[model samples]
Target: MDRPTRWTRATVYPDMWVDPADDPRNSDGVSPDGELPTLVDYLGRYRATLLMKCDDLDAEQLARRSVPPSTLSLLGLVRHLAEVERDWRGWITPGAVPPRLYGSADGDFEGAAPDPSLVARAFADLAREQAATDTALAAHPDPGERLGADGIAVRELQVHRIEEYARHCGHADLLRECIDGRVGQ
Candidate 1:
């Protein structure tokens, strides 16, 4: 038996890279397609990119904090994003509580390390949080509807989520590169 290749095997061809104008799904939707009309689509696509960036990495690789003085890793990002989704839900939909997936606010980034179990838990929590956020968003389809204690519009919040994921995804790029010389979208 042979050990599998690590991050070096994850590859992206030139055509597969995400284009700025194109929707993240990599395909035009329908004839005269209306485009992704909601924040969910945009943010969800960004989240997919983040996950794609980490695909095939082992727990040690995922949890490797390549950047010094910063506790940022792909695993940490997954945990952080899960908490972020829950926080946003709390802001917009008061009295409708979802159990906090990652425990404390800073715990996501704090406790993460190069451990397989912790890394697996991070990914699991991310998936659960994403599902919950989708459910909450579906309950109110109209993006124009004002939600959250700050009266933040759902659309704007969704865009913010996209921005958040996009930024962290960039971080993941650098971290992944540092960890194993892998690069690109």
Candidate 2:
């Protein structure tokens, strides 16, 4: 039996690939003028990077667990990120964070099965949640603006969003590499 050749994706830069066209999310010349926009731009770039890692992979590949003691997968990442978006967006409001997207006790990871339907739903959820979050942030031009009874600063949350995306994108990179040799920043 012969193994198939798995080609590692070639990137034009450490942070981006030379795809059919340039990946706009590769942080190409991301010149953010203000703090809020900077944070938003970073978060958006990481979000796109995560999706790029999962691009063109099948459901099974997306759902491949990281290792024996973990259930982390690209699908899990997608679901988890969606939940993260939902939660943080909720926090932007004074009210309690809305109910989590996945009600399962195991959290978003449990719903991360290798099914095309799940993949579709996860992406849709992320898009809708991101749009809502962006709208919420857009209402607050000043990053110093505070919200809620506890007075959580919008800047803190935006920066936190960027951090969260960055961390998850790191995890996603490993998962993607494990699924295939394809590696990129």
Best prediction by TM-score = 2
lDDT at residue 129 of model 2 (Cα atoms): 85
Question: lDDT per prediction?
Answer: 0.74, 0.79
For model 1, how does the per-residue alpha-carbon lDDT over 2-79 read when each residue is reduced to its tens digit? 323233332344333434454245656643322335455567668888987787788888887755788888888888
Residue runs of model 2 more than 4 Å from their true location after superposition: 1-7, 11-16, 19-21, 26-30
Residues forming the 10-long window of minimal summed lDDT in candidate 1: 1-10
TM-score of 1: 0.80
Give the TM-score of each candidate: 0.80, 0.87
RMSD of each: 5.3, 2.9
Pull out the clashing pairs in model 2. Answer: none
Clashing pairs in 1: 92-148
Q: For this target, which candidate reaches the highest lDDT against the unseen true structure?
A: 2
Candidate 1 runs further than 4 Å off: 1-24, 28-38, 96-100
